[model samples]
Target: MATATGKNAKKTNKQTDTAGTKSSQKDGGSYQAKDIEVLEGLEAVRRRPAMYIGTTDARGLHHLLWEIVDNSVDEFLAGETDRINCTLHKDGSSITVSDNGRGIPVDKHPKTKKSALELILTTLHAGGKFSDKNYARSGGLHGVGSSVVNALSTEMIATVRRDGHEWMQSYKRGQPTAGVKQVRRIRGHGTTIFFRPDDSIFRRTKFNPETIRQHLEDISFIHGGLKIFFHDETKGETHELHHPEGIGAYLEKITTDGQKKSVHEIPFSTEKDDRGNRIEVVLHWTEATDEEVRSYVNGIRTHAGGTHESGLRTGVAKAVKNYMDVHDIKAKGVTVTNDDIREGIVTIISVFLGDPMFQGQTKEKLNNPELSGQVEGLIRPGWKRGSTPTRRLPTRSSAGSCSPPALAWPA
Candidate 1:
């Protein structure tokens, strides 16, 4: 470890050696070759980036953005940060992200012994999120976000302000190009990452402003007053996505009532026994063109609705039909498909937990098979117990599932 011009630099060197033994944990006992397993080097990420971040195209590139954004969001959940800034550089080959959050700890990780910052960047499947004590809720709890991004980037610069000083590190293709070094002393705290995607891994390195805008807008809705600043230097534009009313504002923007009667917004919230789990649900129906049900597990989007959503659908359909039965509204041949029950429904389900089991490379689905039933069990009862409002839901034109609208990027 090298010290620089900072008041805190004279303190004890918090750096540790990058040496450790591979061990397996079984029945709370540690063992060793049967225990020791290795993933070789950066080759796994290069060969299977999609299995980690979802796609190899523009969406995958955007997933890199999410990985970095997730760290900032983790800070928000940890109650240490509130504002985040994302800038697309003029060259189009790089992105610079800065967040006013509790910066990544610059201390040494006990296991790997290197500066935690360096270990997180150079190694795979390592970070502070593994244990619930480290974070109350996290999006990249699997610890693949930063490492995967580093592996796929041609270059990366990470800077952190903590303990009254600024520490910096850089990486080239997942390996450190320079050792961890302190640069300057700074007030307050934050982390900034500037990276250029590897042309060898990513077919293109250009940034998409509209895509970033939409994502920041969506995240702003979820986070409610959290400020997110967007700067497209390539396009010479800057904007902020912040909503005081939160999801309500998001729904109002996307929903328009046509022939449907004004129905009460059915609000439901429940916490599970899964130690540090929260599920918040808001649902309302309109005469809108489609059903928009977005599910999130610990801030990560579950685009391919998993079992949790399936349970939600089943609970909604059952509750509605039960209410219809109680009212003696004689209607024949009416069966509630997930589609039928959710028609014109604008709903957002947010689940926050320390650890999320996600499906596949892109993590498009929540993979905690048990949690699906857990959410259903917790939420279904709420719906069943709530008083069902009386209103004739207008017949809606069925517009199946939504796909990404036309967005311009490299082919």
Candidate 2:
């Protein structure tokens, strides 16, 4: 009986030891440098293109166009280029964007010892947008737009006409297939990029002309005097987008839609704080109760309203409340609110600064706290000037009560 008990204990100890070894093997098999994976250069971008371009859907397809177009727009803002052309091939496989800006530097980079054009195309965060000397204000602030677009493209061709020569380079899936070679002697200065989206990375590869047209129109409206030409080889149609009046023209189109009646004959516009950081505002009110407020920071649209928008609202509200109080106007048992002042109003607020802080890569909103106070201070005077009446207020109304006078905005 004693020998049998000892044998049973030994069996239990063996089973426990075997179970512990299996558990250890499962938890800590091997930890070494080989276990870690490092993605170099544009490999990380190809592995996670969605993270850079937002998504792999139709919006991402459109974003590729915008990224390229924005580079041209930055050139326009820098006063280097006035004209840009975009063409969509009939086969729905390729698109080309050409701009009349100073062609990308063709000289070899000092650090990489590669052609500046090649360095700009192959490396991430390599561009003039990072330096204040090359660009005072730019839409492509991150400097990753072009390279990301190049990485996701299956085939890309870049052409530059500068230094009395036309240079050309080709790439396949972000790798240079050919060196920067001279195509021919040329007179003009500009850069052209032609690329085909990779089918494996995107769910759809076709280019949408209408969507591209709309985006170009918005960009043209935002930056007046920048001409954009869009040609669709598929439909043999061409469209030109140019707005000289800037956001004021955009507001005019919004007011003429026939759904709203304008309270002012012309929009009120003001430019202030012009020493370094500048704020520009254009605003008008309509009969409908819907509010349309568009804000931008350094040319990038802020769909998500930021502190700058908040400042505009606060300034307008304060100015309107002051006008109402001075005029002795009263709503029955109701306190005036910011919404009440903004009802049926259309406003465009644009800020130009040395450095802008955005929340994320997409730049949906502005995060600079100083802009809120600056915008408020800049726009309050404009609102006061627009709301102040030229004529004196009446002593009393027919019913022995005071009523508010009609509000008018300047042309």
Q: What is the lDDT of residue 193 in candidate 1?
A: 95
Q: Give me the candidate number with maximum TM-score.
A: 2
Residues 1-411 of candidate 1 have per-residue lDDT tens digits of 776546554333332211222122333345444886566777689887877777778989989988898889888888888899999999987998898887888897777778989888777778878886868778876677888899999899999998999999999988889888989888989999989898888878787889989888888888886899999998899998888676655655655423443245443334455555677666666656466788877667789988768777776666655555555643344433456556666777777766677776467887676666667666555644544444344333354323211111111
Instruction: Tell me the tens digit of each residue's lDDT in model 2 across 1-411.
Output: 444358798998899899998987888757667899999889999999978888998888778877888888889888999999999999876999999899999899988899999999899888987778988887787778888988999999999999999999999989999899999998999999999998899999998888888778877888888999999999999999989989888878767754777765667787776657878898877777678888887777788989899999998777666667766766554555577667778888888777788776667788888888887777665544545432112222234323444444433
Scored by CA lDDT, what does every candidate get? 0.73, 0.81
Q: Candidate 1: TM-score?
A: 0.79
Off by over 4 Å in 1: 1-39, 256-275, 332-338, 377-411
Clashing pairs in 1: 51-361, 54-362
Question: Could you tell me which residue pairs clash in candidate 2?
Answer: none
